[model samples]
Target: MLQRASNANQYFTHWVTAAPESRELLALCLRKLRGLNKVRIIDASFVWTEPHSKRIKVRVTVQQEAFEGAIIQQSFEVEYVVASQQCPDCAKSYTANVWRASVQVRQKVPHKRTFLYLEQLMLKHSAHKETINIKEVKDGLDFFFAQRNHAEKFVDFLSSVTPVRVKKSQALISMDIHTSTKSYKFTYSCELVPICKDDLVCLPIKLAKQIGSIFPLALCHRIGTSINLLDPNTLQTADLPSNTYWRAPFASLANATELVEFVVLDIEPLGEQSGRFFLAEATVARASDMGVNDNTYFCRTHLGAVLHPGDSVMGYHLTGTNFNDPQFQELENSSTYSSRIPDVLLVKKFYARKKKPKRNWRLKRMAKDEGELLPKKADQDRMDADYEMFLRDVEEDVEMRNTLALYKAENKKEADAMSMTETDLDDDDEVPKISMDELLEDFEDLQVGE
Candidate 1:
């Protein structure tokens, strides 16, 4: 005889095997397919009937979601057979049944409506005017000009509304420091060029901090060499009081060169600990020549921050060597060293602290629970009994006997020396030797040692 299987058999089996609740099963399935663009699940039903003496037939129908906001239907059919057999060795009778079922699952194509709607929203609500020269724009929306390729359109829009024609400009700044003389200088110049004002406004204190932090490690080797050059004996012991306004000689090279003009944006005090330090943000008149070796080189140097009269600025001599290569290499090495020491120590300490909780918590809880479980008198008696048992066990062990023998031999040597010393002291007094039988009698009268 052939037996039919229901369409819900495997589906229900998998669902039940997965979790106790249907909602959990559904959540797990959804999590598995989260990255899929479009997905649809169908409720399927099957009907089975015995068509012949040895075969069973099944018909299946499934409902699935379709693209373009419609429902899709699919169907399939299958058959199975049954046979009787006996085990060859055991002589056990058995019935064998084979069954098959066909099912069709449909998937829908992803719809493009959401993306189209977003595009429409962007076009409608976006700033219509090309150039938005607000005092400040949101950081996320500030790159609209480059992102949309609307630079020309924005400039055209700006020219029509504002009387001051929008023009691009470049700035130049130079910094120099003398270690022997302990002096520093900074000069700023501004030149008009062809760039947007949004790029110019990007200069701020945060940017200055980002640049200044790199200065210390970037010129570490140079600074170390300069410190070594100083006569240690002549080095001042007392910390010098920083001046309010320390002046250094500054030369404006931009005035002599027609390439780029620089303007001093603003100079503000960053923060004062032992000495004063300032951050200067400037606009470059020309962007083309704004590299380390170019007129803009000084802006990136250590001398960018003004120094006090006694304070020394640590930096490479930009006049003689390739400043960019050594500066970058030194920064990379310092950054690598900085990352290793702190990060490894932090991870080790974190895991060590994490591991301690298991033993610590257990000990604390055990102490608290033990206080209620055992009376003080009972605990004390138990400890005393345990200690006595331990001593007896140790005394009976063969290894412990050997250890005691070794200790006795060492003690015997010290006792023999003392006996010899006593004998030497008694040399002045005549001492008579005793017979073996008499000594044995004296030893028998002594009590046994523990």
Candidate 2:
């Protein structure tokens, strides 16, 4: 069954350890019918008199056989015994190190935001469905697969979505006694790129000249297999591939910190009147500490059109080492560079945090009686009436038709199964018990009749 490529012909026996449905039983019995004089089964089905019972009565009828003769009719009954045990998937889940291959993903960033975002993408694309387990780690996520190909497939999916650097390694676990070929366990290490959106980077002079963007600085607009950089001054853009960024990684990361409220003293628009970029003279100080640095300082921003002379706006300051300095410079450039960096090279705009309406946050929860929590008696009565109406509708429950068939076969009387079931259900009467001996005698009688 495992080797078969098509599920249409697969058959599950009683050893399958789960309740086989009517379709599974029919498929099993059809295989049995094929062996009897090469019989072609016309119809095969199963029935369970007692719901939730493992015992199934399979009825089969054949319309054609290998031998030609007068029309022959036959009805046969087959019984299946199902036992309870752990399934293969459940066993793999319970066992440790059962996976053949695992993909380990990591990021150098401090936060788990990129990993969490990848998790959502994986779920949307169903990239990890074949994985035995998906675990979240402090740095990233781990995906374990029953087959090596499934792990590789998920890794490909991860690479398609994000910039991932991969390396593979294997460890010998055991050796074969006959061929002496060692069996090795495999693992793939996929590390996501460290930089992310809206980060400030101190660009290297060599890369700066190649990309033709803002010199010595750029802001990250997007992060993928390629990095998209935008010149904060000129609004120009440069997209560098992963290999290029790695080979010349002089872009020192500048973390985006908390918002700083800068009071506007003077504002002037740059270029055309319709342009978004603006030149502003503003003071630098924390929102909490409004005392120091009240004097105006030169600052450039794209949001100057919205600000008035007194309105307060927030911004993020870039902080990083100077890449052109002799201490960090690997390449020689004749042009002079600043030994000491600016106090704050640039301040990127952030959303002005709005103050929310005040309300009591810690209201005490109350305890109530169980009777109050339970459904009201009126609701219970309505539910009972609705159920009764549903029982009267035989079309809603096809199994109820079997009760009619049994009544007609035993009593030879025309009766409505829905009405009979409804009357019995409404009575709330206890079922009369029958002994094993009586059941055995009834079975014998049924056999004799057949």
Candidate 3:
């Protein structure tokens, strides 16, 4: 209890630790002095120096009418002690490799082009933001998350954009006997379809019949949520959905690595046209066999609109070539599909280039953590080749370039100022380049030093 001063009426002061506000402090004082007689709190006000100040002054007014029907007032002050603390869940985030769930994405193919494309898609959609860490493995990438739901969300994103089959499993991490609580670490093993764009996939007989009766030897022209295939002989196109692909999956017989160059001897376009593809018959001879032999191959191609008589083209030579795939062997043995198979399936027309053209624009790459184990010399070379192929595809395919962010190269002015020889000028004219309008200025480099 507090009483009036002997010399004069004085205001009383009190200190409180971590008291919230004036109203709460007044309530606390009222509760403490509830047992006292004829004492009532009228109002209270608080003033703080800063928004998050640790100390505050609270003025609380009290009224006492016990002395000869006269009223007396008093004030009080409180100081709060602020401290920081972390909960168990938040503390786990600061620790290394403390993920509760992980998604291991894998592809059985021998190249990394598909993974590079998937990385761009994930970055464009901002799907990788939820992941705690992304580590690159030999075949694919592994995404880690602090929660199972985050991993599931990432898996859903992968399934939506690409053809992948997911196998989920959970491991027991910890258990509490008193609370009957169990902690689990979940793992999602996701395997992407081995097929990629521009690859020659030998579809299963039954699967081919189901997808619009297209040819078994079809070229994967485009791959999105579904695999888009084109039959060069008939110019017929079909789509193989992700679900259908996983149920009866088949591998690609030949990819860009197996492409054999051929010079177009003659080309005549037919009246039939499907979008950008024009049906035409072409007489092509192997580039290696041009001067040695007069042998030439007569085949149907869909690139008639773009190909010229003297142009070089890349295609897969099927005649006299033996493949170990069961699907290809079955097609070869079957009387129904054996005769319909073409000797050559032209993939893309090639442009003459003595050297790589100087580009004024560049693409941004995702910062991914490749594992600590250094790759072997052969594996490293293969990876480099695959990345170069991906870069070329990005440059040639306008649709692909649209999905990625292109920035103006920092050395664009220097590249533009450099003089090119006659040969370099000719190469620059032949090679595809991105326009300046399509590239965005990168302002991240504009930050001035503090």
Candidate 4:
């Protein structure tokens, strides 16, 4: 309700977010009056808008002395009970296997870090507000919605953030014979690209030639709708976009945990401090150092300008594994997976010495996860003040105040036109065209129209 308007007797006014319209409220009053069937209604009026009353005014004509024709009028407020009934969509929200559309979101990579980060991102964006329910699966998450268009919107959001391939399918739920209408349940499968930050991948030999790289190795640097790869030897960058990656699919070589720490032994400028990379000579710290020194490796970093000889760095090194072990395969026949990649690939440099990560992983950690991240005191105050925090906009109940105002304006104009009395004289000219009194009369006319 609005603050008291000035001159309340002349222009009754109130500010309301929503209220029952004249029809629904008036119906309740009519029903009550009809309950007393003895009364015959001659005239009834309902007033409940601008120049509005605190209560909905309803006047019904009642005959005081029957058959004598003397009548009296009685006025009362319209009233109705506010009842709650489960809507069609709300009824289905609590049941299982009742989804009109579902989205299965999964990533090819084994790590769950990307999915974890995605959860926070969606929370901030309010993406799941329209979703019926969310389920956590082994590979990723599943989203359920009441409409297929809602699922499509979520899929588009995912595609914007990650390189994903989408497949859509629908199953027929039922076909109405009389109405000749059919209903279907849709399913959207979104496959996120397996590559993530710090994962090692083996470039195809053909792709290596195409990328102008002699070594068939690259380390995943960053992932943002596309995979960013960095060459440890040359510090060269390559992008794997959603459009072209399908043609030359790279094989997953290893993860970030497979990396070993290397002590920086020597440093050299690649080209310039402002260039792409810096070169360095480093010795890999073995599990147990042998009596004789070995395992000295040539490594590269993007932050070589800030690095010194003694600074330690963590990166992936291509050492012998069971898959490529000599004992597992006869080296003589170099048939299929013969040509192996080079020694090392750089991922990141440790700006802070103590918290140096042994492996590189995409996505940052959240401080707290829930509805809000603020402290309890401040969060509670915000929750109390927010009128629409937990409320969903009901399409039918949305107040079309703009349209209502326009209608009221037009209706008032028509009312004024009809209320207008004809000129008292024969013609408008006979009314004294431009006298001082005529001018004052014109101002009065404007005030009445207003």
On TM-score, the candidate that comes out on top is 3
lDDT per residue for candidate 3 within 30-130, as digits (tens), equals 44444345667677666565745534455656778767877877766544433333333334434566889999999988788888888778867888897
- Cα lDDT computed for each candidate against the true fold: 0.24, 0.51, 0.76, 0.52
Model 3 compared with the native: what TM-score?
A: 0.74
Q: Evaluate model 1: give its lDDT.
A: 0.24
Expressed as tens digits, the lDDT of each residue in 156-211 for candidate 2 is: 98778777778898765444344766655689999777776556666676666787
TM-score of every candidate? 0.13, 0.49, 0.74, 0.51
lDDT of 1 at 448: 83
In angstroms, the error of model 2 at 212 is 2.4
The 10-residue segment of model 4 with minimum total lDDT is 387-396
Which stretches of candidate 4 lie above 4 Å from their native place?
1-97, 211-215, 273-284, 287-294, 322-341, 350-450
What is residue 29's positional error in candidate 4, in angstroms?
55
Q: Sorted on TM-score, highest at the top, how do the candidates line up?
A: 3, 4, 2, 1
Q: Candidate 1's error at 150, in angstroms?
A: 76
Candidate 4, 241-327: lDDT as tens digits: 776776655446776546666566667756533244565444434423333577576645565654567655567655555444232
Best by lDDT: 3
Model 3 poorest ten-residue lDDT run? 416-425
Error of 2 at 181 (Å): 6.6
RMSD each, Å:
36.5, 28.8, 16.7, 27.7
